[model samples]
Structures are given as structure tokens and as C-alpha cells.
Target: MPYTRPARPPPEEASLQGSELAHEIVDVLVDRQAEDVVLLDMTSLSVFADYFVIATVDNPRQARAVVDAVEAHVLADGRSRPKVEGAADSSWILVDLGEGIFVHVFTEDSRAFYNLEGLWNRAQEVVRVQ
Candidate 1:
């Protein structure tokens, strides 16, 4: 499929600054068997963040597990706890590790609705974890 550009650049480059931390979070998700892991590079666009790490879990249980793994890993790495949002319903969870790594954990329906991959068409795709 063709790529699509985000409506606006990320609010800051903070997300891109902590890429290693982001990668660690991705690794944790993968380890937990998260599905459809994807990394979006938003460096070229005018935005606040530099990168977006998106992934999917099969269900609410997995969604929560993914977030837990991310939190634990980031903390273990000695980074500040990420500012997380959207966990109440567990359909879509956003973990903000200020600088340039924004993580999104979404359910199938939510993932389809947000279509982040489609929205960030212009951003470079770093990887797609099957």
C-alpha cells in the first residue's frame, strides 16, 4: 500500500531523541508477542516528535501486557517513566517518552480507525514486526 503523510508534524523532537529507549520498548513488546509492530520515522515532517512506534495486541489483555512490558523496560533502562495515556479502555494506549519516541498500542478496530500507518504515509517505515 502507498504511504500517507501525517496532518501535522509531531509537537516536538523529543520523541526522536530517545530512540534507543523506543527500540527497547519495541523489543519488550515483541518479547511479549505483540503483533504487527511498526516504527514510523517522522523526522522529515514539521512536528514535535521524530519517531512513532506503533504496535498491536490481539486483545485487551495483550494490550495491557504490552504497556506493562514497555513501562517496565523503560524504567529498567533508567529512563524516566513515560507519560502514558489511553489505558482506561485498553483499545489504544499511547506511551509518551518525551523527545521523539511515542508508542501506540492499539486493538484491531482502533488501529483500523486511527489508521496511523496510513496517516503517516510520508514518514519512513523503519520496520514492520510480524
Candidate 2:
């Protein structure tokens, strides 16, 4: 599937409202040794999503694992399952959690090419997980 940028949230709204769930998702990524976990504040950028979580996994297997972790975390927390994309190929998996969008398990080359951080330059860097 092509890369579709999600809708941005309102500027005045607080993206961190889902901080607890975000932390849980970040924890899962970190535990799996995902790289460069970045939280992008998309409040002023667009009106669709609040935050964007980006990270990289080493390989296909790890990609799937990361997706599983995110799915498990959100479901366990009583939140709905994110609208997942790109899981079959395990190259770039995007978990759309409504208020937040999580991009997991990308290869180094893919991550570098997409450069989500650079693309959303206007977004404030909320946190960086190792």
C-alpha cells in the first residue's frame, strides 16, 4: 500500500492525552530493540491524528513481532485495534490508533528513505526512546 499520511489533530488539543498508551507502545518497541523511537506532535500539522510514533526493526520477523506487541498493548488496554497497513510484507507496518499513528518495524534503508521526521519538520519532538 502507498504511504498515506493520516489526518492531523487540532492544534489546541493535547496529543499527550494518550501518553500512557504511547508509553506502552514505546516500551514494546524498545523491548524488541527497535531503533530511533520518535514521537512527532502532529497537532498543528494536520487535523487527523494527534501524534506519530516512528521506529525501526531489524528484519521481517522483528517487524511482525513489533506489530504484535502494539496490537496486544492497545487491545489489552481496552482500546480498539489500530488500522494496520504493510504487515504482510513486513517492511513498514503502520498502526493507526485514531488519536495516534504508530509506524513500526522498518528496515534501516526504508526508514532513512522515508525520513518521517524530516517530512513532519513542523511537528515538535515530544520524546525519543533510545
Candidate 3:
């Protein structure tokens, strides 16, 4: 229950007991209407985080909805509020759910431009929600 960061994929999603939090985040992203929601398992690939929940948003409003929904769900589940990176209008946003869980939210163009999936191509793709 104390923050223990996962050691692989992720940017700003919680690490509440590791994979459990990552999966929980995936659910939240889907519930909020995120597109191309992907849960990347970086346990064997990265060093900074354990899991990455990358999602695509349509606009700033959709981005806010995704981030807000993630925060609300995590808090309601008894974890502290996660740290969020980027402005409300940012093309890309990161939610740091401390301890190695990261959530990356980006606009379609931004998602394509950054190409995290391409960068971490070696990381195992765990759960992908449409």
C-alpha cells in the first residue's frame, strides 16, 4: 500500500502494489473514452517505470476528462492523488502515479509524433483497449 514504484514502463500512473495499479489505470482510461489505450509491460525493458498506459485523446477536453477520471478513480481506490505533468492545454500529458506507474495521454498527432510505442517497441504489450 505504501508507494512502491515499478521498474519498467509508464510515465504518471500509480504503482500501488505494481501490476494491480497498472491494470486499474487501463480500466480508467477505457472508461473515459480514451483511444488506442495500451498497457505496456516494461518490467524487462525499462528502468524508470514498470508499466505504461498510453492513450490517445481527441482534444483538450477529452484529455482533461481522461486525466481527471484517472485521478478520481485512483483516489477513490484509497491511493493518494497521482502527480500530473503538462498543462491542461498541453498536447501531451503525463500522470505520475508514483512508484513507476505512468500514464501518457496525447493527442492523435502528438501520439504519432512522439511515437512511444515505436520507442519502446521491445516492451511487451500487455493489455490494449480500443
Candidate models: Cα lDDT each: 0.80, 0.75, 0.88
TM-score each candidate.
0.82, 0.81, 0.85
lDDT of 2 by residue, 65-97 (tens): 888888887788776777888856667878888
Best by lDDT: 3
lDDT of 3 by residue, 1-130 (tens): 7999657544333344678888988988888889999999988887888889999999978998899999998899888889999999998999998757899999999999999999999999999888
- Give candidate 1's error at residue 47 in angstroms: 2.2
Q: Given candidate 2, what's the lDDT at residue 4? A: 96
lDDT of 3: 0.88
Comparing candidate 2 with candidate 3, which one achieves the higher TM-score?
A: 3
All predictions: root-mean-square deviation over Cα? 9.8, 6.8, 5.7
| Deviation from native of the Cα of residue 120 in model 3, angstroms | 0.5
Q: Sort the candidates on TM-score, descending order.
A: 3, 1, 2
